[model samples]
Target: MEAKQLNIGDNVKKFRELKGFTREQMADYLNLSVSAYGNIERNKTDLTVSRIQQIAEILEVDLAQTLNFDASQVFNITHNEVIQGMHSKVENHNHPDEYKEKYIKMMENEIARLKKLAGEA
Candidate 1:
């Protein structure tokens, strides 16, 4: 769905409920009143960048996912330059030719690289 069509507040509310939290509980976690939190999820209130960030963290999700933000448009705009840089860096790295021939080892290395890029490792 288009980012503009997606309701960020609705996504947040859905996630909170899926995690078994009531509006009061989520409000308590965010140091907001139940009425304020209700407004947020209902999109009756405006959420600032800092508030959205805080909500993303509390929900343990990325801002893009929380907002249903379309990231591909952004990436596409920068891809020519950024992908070129990544390609050059990858080429400079010395990996074994024999390792490339092995499926398991290559998969492991790919996973490691992805994790590192995502800051999960």
Candidate 2:
């Protein structure tokens, strides 16, 4: 039952292929260019939790599985109420301009941290 240490990108490709989804189809669904999606599948870009969530949703898999994370650990990290609130705020577009900018910068910094963790920066 052992498997190769495939990264998230590898898992994504495996599931996408298994589910009969074309690369172009996934790219369109994610609103990304074909090349951009290719880079993601190749693990050439920093993978974000949100992006992983989107992929997992698209492929009908668990986000924890998509990230190769333990279910309990992933839930603790990804299911924080504060983080969820931030996402809701961003999505709902209810924040004022200044708050929006501040949140954007904070998110940018977090993405940078994620990139560093992934060794993409």
Candidate 3:
């Protein structure tokens, strides 16, 4: 399905509703007076970068998603699950026994150095 096009007010309102926040509640969270925040949601004011960041955090969205309102683009650019899975697989590789031994030894040495530096050796 084609993603719905959302303007700034649409994004703001959608996210607020998704989070179950009314304009007054969201304004309280933003430390803005209700009228000021209402202006933002009504598209009468531009969102500053800091405000956008704050709204993204409040909406539990990424900065890009708040600014662009492109849900697909947001997911594509910021998906962490795939990357984390790949990293986990690589870290658990059943490599040559010799390689595993070397990796362990390296880690041990690093830990020993850290302990010594911290006077905890």
lDDT per residue (tens digit) for residues 2-120 in model 3 = 98654677677755643445687677677789999988888888777888887776666787777665534322221112122122211122334443454456558767998999999
lDDT scores for all predictions? 0.59, 0.63, 0.61
* Candidate 1 lDDT, 67-89, residue by residue in tens: 87332322221111112212221
Error of 2 at 18 (Å): 0.6
Query: lDDT score, residue 34, model 2?
Result: 97
Residue 95 displacement in candidate 3 (angstroms): 43
The estimated TM-scores of all candidates read 0.52, 0.52, 0.51
How badly does each model clash, as a count of residue pairs?
0, 0, 0
What residue runs in model 1 are displaced by over 4 Å at the alpha carbon?
A: 1-6, 69-121
> Could you give the candidate ranking by lDDT, starting with the highest?
2, 3, 1
Per-residue CA lDDT of candidate 2, range 8-119, in tens? Answer: 8866875564444679877877889999999988989897889999888776568867766332322122111212212221112232444345445655876799999999
